[model samples]
Target: MRKDLHEANRLSWNAATRAHNSHKGDQAQFFRNGGSTLFPEELALLGEVHGLKALHLQCNAGQDTLSIARLGADITGVDISDVAIDFATQLAADAGIPARFERADVFDYLAHAAESSVDLVFSSYGTLCWLSDLNAWAQGIARVLKPGGRFVFIEFHPYAMVFDQDWTMCYDYFNTAPLAESGVSDYVAESGDGLAVGEYQAGEQDFVNPHASHEFTWGVGQVTTALSQAGLCVARLDEYPYANGWKGFDGMQDSGGRRMVPPTGMPRIPLMYSIVAQR
Candidate 1:
């Protein structure tokens, strides 16, 4: 069950949820204002979700979940962090969006779901990193999905994740080892404030959080192969040189307020990738 990994990450994310919900950014504002968190690329891949029964895995503060519900899908979101689920539930209610949120490890949640009951399984950026097993994850996606149901996912490319902030190769692309680190930053805002659960690292750090996290690296091929092995047909795969979300790269610039483009003179790299699969 990866209990230790789950516990560590849960604490980290619980801390992150607090900061994220209160941060005064477009993400926090948009969710509070009932705005959609989805970008154009995934939205186009989603096609028509009207009236579909969709399950959003690792759904953080329900911003994206509510966004999908606004598209007319019967949405249910699941996350490992109880704090995240609670905030998501409250956010949905405040947004007047009818949705459900459950705090459970995604694998366990999918295990108990009725077979072939869900029309769609969805997840987005920074999701797969928290997972230790892609094969089991894909199987879960296949388990709850109705026949011909779709799995839409987008994540930071492993190729891009291997590099550090300075674009130096600091990590392995195919490393299966659990990368553990303390004193990480909250992406939602620049300050941890009440969210810090551990001692913040001194000297020029990003968003500060005391909690530690465990992450695993999986390559693009591993993801596709796992989905295919789990009885899902790969329908589409796309890679983008720019990212829809921040990746903590130095000197990256925004592209038309939509994507974060790499700095000038830097060699092109795949910052993100997407996959659409059918059960």
Candidate 2:
């Protein structure tokens, strides 16, 4: 892993964390009222985790993590951003949910994580790009998972990643370079999906973080192959034409819930995907 680059991203996330929350109001109250941030796709794949030891990686703000806790699972969420972890911890307390939040880089946290300590590992939504080393990630996951435990991964597909926010082709599908984004605008409420949740009405704000973020675009093949080499058996891979919340182009319609889809007649490509791999 590129520690330097990863450090830079941590700073960026710290800054972005505040910006991400700035658009929202009363997050603690939302959790207290039994609100959730999880999409239906994860719910179906999650099955039953009641009383199972679980881990949520890169859990920002812990809204979804707390939701999982509602399912009666003992879960701890880990993230690299201090601000995010702090917010998550406080939210857990405010919501009266029993959970643990740790601030650590995923790789280092995984390195020191006890082998065979967890029954399930869950990670989702815009997580992989910030990770610099997938092999180490896979090995760490393989090491931590107990016998027969599976890792549930949900993410935006790399095929859809080639297009920018405007649906224009701006990146190479096979690109292996680190993307450095500086002075980026906030995405929480900009996608129009955030406001669609019908929870507390967010306040209007223009937010931007100047910190440079170092990210990578590891494709589907690279990820599955890494897990295979790390002794994890890939049990399932599912692709969806709809995306969760973040709409990348105009004319995107709501697919009956928080999911959004491309305009009516465009060629359908995978906007998101999920994988289930067992140790």
Candidate 3:
């Protein structure tokens, strides 16, 4: 991964971090009231994290990190955004959750991480797209996991990323270039997934971010192959017809609660996928 590319993304995430938090109004209070930002999909995948040393990569603001800590895991939340780590640190303190937050490039953190150290490596939602080198990411994951340790991951299907928000096929699934996007932080309009499943709704905030982002897309096959090459056995690969929390496409229907499914009459396709790789 080029340092300049990652640095640009880091700056962008730093600028957008506050906007993401604006949507989740008063998160410190939310956690203090015993609220969790996790969804059922990830919870089922991360079954029984108690007593495990868990690492959460790309943990923006640490909502899910604190949630996992509440589940009895000794967890560390990591992100590239400095503002995000600061906010997460304060949130953990305010919520009285025992956890650690570190601001570093995922690859850097993984490179320096003790080998065979963590019991679980977890990430979810829009994680893979931020990675510039899949091989390095996979190797890092394998290096940090204990023998028999699991890497539980759920991410937006690459197939779904080929389309624009208006249901137009605007991007190539196999595109290899770093996609450059300016003002990519559309935080105010975020919806479709939350702790109460949008029951405790907060009105959209007027938000703006000036930084740009650089992102990459890796196919499911490529991701699984990387993990295999890194000496991790792929234990499970599951595809879901619906996406949790993110409503990126137009005409998506709420399948009760946070699950967002394609509009009626649309052909079924994988919108999200999960993988369990054991080291």
Candidate 4:
């Protein structure tokens, strides 16, 4: 793993957690009020998860972890950010929901997991871009799963990620290069309000309020190939023309409170995708 890149991205997400958990416009309140963060697509794909042993990777703030637990699954949430994990732990306790949270790099945690011990390994939206290596990720998912265990993952489509927030083609669809940005704003802020909170340097230059994010793009083929090479059989692949929420987009009409798809006369695109793979 690229430790440098991981550390850089971790700092940004750690900072993001603060804003996300505190902002009134964010889902923290909903989660605290016993709302499920699990989207409809993932819930449908993960039908009947009751009484399963589940592992939620990159489970920021433990909202989804608690959601799954509410569905009768024994869940353990893992995240790289210590601050985030701390918050998740407290959130779970405050909500009187039984959950376990660990702070560690996902790769390291999976490396130490008991072989064939987990019944299901899950992750969701905006989870894939932070990692520099997808093969290792798939291998980790395979490593922790029991025979016939399932790996259910949902993520923003790589093709959709190629566009900027305005849906304009601004980035390379097939680019493998890592992207670095500074002075990042909180993505979940109802408006452009919250800002990054630390000092950072991108060389000899130093800046204040510097939140740094480093992300890598992986293609659809890359994702499927990695899962296949990791010994997991792809049981189902579903593509959706909508995202769970508006991603700072314009001209998108809300289908319901939970979904936003392209309006009429607009060319459709795959905004998100879900994969169900089994060991």
CA lDDT of each prediction against the hidden true structure: 0.81, 0.86, 0.86, 0.78
TM-scores of the candidates in the order shown: 0.90, 0.95, 0.94, 0.89
- Model 1, range 190-252, lDDT digits (tens) per residue? 322211112222323345677998888899999999999999999999999988757367777
Evaluated against the true structure, the overall lDDT of model 1 is 0.81
Answer with 1 or 3, whichever has the higher TM-score. 3
| Candidate 2 lowest-lDDT run of ten | 193-202
Q: Candidate 3 on 253-274: residue-level lDDT in tens?
A: 8887578888999898899999
Model 4 lDDT tens row, 165-252: 7778899988868888673345545322211111111221122325778888888889999999999999988898887754456666
Candidate 4 runs further than 4 Å off: 24-33, 190-209
Query: Could you tell me the lDDT of residue 126 within candidate 3?
Result: 85
Q: Report model 2's TM-score to 2 decimal places.
A: 0.95
Q: Which runs of model 1 end up more than 4 angstroms from their true locations?
A: 25-34, 190-207
Clashing pairs in 2: none
Better of 2 and 4 by TM-score: 2
Ten-residue region with minimum lDDT total, candidate 1: 191-200
Q: Local error of candidate 3 at 127, Å? A: 1.0
Pairs clashing in candidate 1?
185-207, 198-210
